[model samples]
Target: MLSPESAEIVRATLPVVGASLDTITTRFYTSMFTERPDLLDGLFNRGNQANGEQRRALAGSIAGFAKALLDHPEERPDRLLSRIAHKHTAVGVTDDQYVIVHKYLFGAIADVLGEAATPDVIAAWDEVYWLMGGALIALEARIYAQVGADDGRTWRQWRVVERREETPDVVSFLLRPIGDDPVPPARPGQYVSVRVRMPDGVHQLRQYSLSGTGEEGLRRITVKRVRGGEGAPEGEVSTLLYDTVRPGDELTLSAPFGDVVLEDGDAPLVFASAGIGCTPITAMLEHLVATGSRRRVLLLHADTSPADHALRQDMERLADALPAAERIFWYEADAPQGARTGRMDLTGVQIPRNAVAYMCGPLPFMRDVRGRLRAAGVAARDIHYEVFGPDLWLGEDS
Candidate 1:
């Protein structure tokens, strides 16, 4: 809980700080990168930086955390913190980096706020920052311990045993550990970070959801080549993986770490996804099939077309194997025999009663589906989602 004096200051200054977060975050990234360019080489995603997504996400998170503290003084935002901590652990973020971030972040704040950033103001916000940071540090420490990554050595070499083309733009890699180190236990809906050296010799990191069962010994990640359009730059790591790194090549992978894992329950499951977001959903389905789950499953997906769907066959085959599973797909063009045409519309679709839904896709798509699911009587707490990149929708529901 925040101290009384600090809370009053934060409450009074939140509006100003929140409004300028974008500028502050931008300045923070610029100044930090100017001094510590090495952070961009391996830790930060240069593509996200170039596109401004990382800056925006940081701004949103800061503003959101402050608002949550002020709005609910009695409780900490564990959900928000857990989401961020998982992502940080996936990228091998250590406790020391929080201090580095604090220095640059506060520097940017002071630089932007100018005269208004008094010592009292800075100290209050500093308390807020450390409160958020401390919670994250503790959560990440527990996660690291659970994954046996407490030593900060999160990366491991894995040999690609098989590479298969899933779609025109997507490929799947079946990987096995290169050493005798036991594979860390993975849960359905979790993801692993893939760190690869770019052509320039600087390593870049990207997270890909496990597209197969979470069983030990082997793992699979499906990659979709991110075609840069609409002012976005092409994904360097994805493009590199797509063009090169064939079977027999070794790639560095982190232990699977994600907060949005499949929950064990007997409730009906609703798995909804679009494009490459289907990876983790497919992994969950594989787990259910492997365990012979008899729970009712409703799988909904949307894509440009059946040809563009990365795991179309796998989805169909898995759903078919399940005794009580139904599959519905939407395509923008070339609707198949039983699938619907046009964008995803759940207006008349029958959502199973008491269904727990999991979604992974673009933000707008997820937001729309979430609203419809709520209208269809699924509780807010029952809806789960995963974003492939930095979470721009951090506090949307809250």
Candidate 2:
């Protein structure tokens, strides 16, 4: 809980701080990266930085945390904190990094706000920052302990056993430990960060969803080659994974971490996805099949065409294996027989009253499905979603 004095100050200056967050974040990254270039090697994603998504995400988080503190001072922002902690742990973020972030962030605030950033304002925001950071540090510590990487080390080498192309732009790699050491188990819908050396000799990292169930000693990750457009650079890690890495190659991966996962229950499940977002949903379905679960499952998917659907066959196979599973597929072109054309719509679909829907896709698609599900009597709490990259969902939803 915030000190009453600080809370009052925060509530009073929140509008000014919120309005200047973008500028503060931009200056923060610019100044921090200029002084600490090594952070760009593997810790920070250059692609996200180049396009300003990282700055935007940081701004959203800070503003959201402050707003939440003012709105519900009696409670903590567990959802926001959990999501951030999971992402940080996936990227091997450590406790000390919080200090570095605090330094540059507040410095940027002081610089941007100038005379307006009085000592009271600074102290109040500092309290908010440390509170958020402290919560993340505690959660991350627990995650590391649970994963048995309590030494703050999270990276491990896994050799690629198979590389199979699922689509023209998507590929699936099956990996296994080089030795007989027991592999850590990952829940369905989790992701692992893969770090690779770029042509410039600097390591870059990218997170890919664990696209398959933990099948004995093996794990799977699906990668979609990211194309550059609209002034954004192409994805360095993904491009290298596609063109250079192959079977027999060893890759560095962080322990699987993500807040969204298939809950252990017999509740009716609806798996909705579009494009490459189908990976995690496929993993959940595979888990259900592996466990011989008899739960009612509804599979909903959308894509540009049948050829463009990365895991169409596997998705269909898993759904077929389930006794009470039903499927509805939408495609913009080349709609398969018995499948609908154009975008997905729930107007005529029969969604079970007790269904818990898990959706992963573009922001627009997930937002649309989320709205439709709510309109059809599904509670907001029952509809969970996953974003492939920086989660722009909560900020926009808020």
Residue pairs with backbone atoms closer than 3 Å in model 1 (clashes)? none
TM-score of each: 0.98, 0.98
* lDDT (tens digit, per residue) of candidate 2 on 1-398: 88899999999998898899999999999999999999998889998888888888888888888888888889998888888888888888888899999999999999999999999889988999999999999999998887879635788899999999999988999998776765667999999999888889888888899999555679999999998888768787888898887899999998889989999887899889999999999999999999999999989999999999998999999999999999999999999798999999888898888789999999899989988888888887788888877776554453
Worst 10 residues of 1 by lDDT: 210-219
Candidate 1 residue spans exceeding 4 A from truth? 214-216
Tens digit of per-residue lDDT, candidate 1, span 29-119:
9999999999987789998898888999988888889888888989999999999999999888899999999999999999999999999
- For residue 118, what is the lDDT in candidate 2? 93
Off by over 4 Å in 2: 396-398
| Cα lDDT, all candidates | 0.92, 0.89
Model 2 poorest ten-residue lDDT run: 389-398
Clash totals for all candidate models: 0, 0
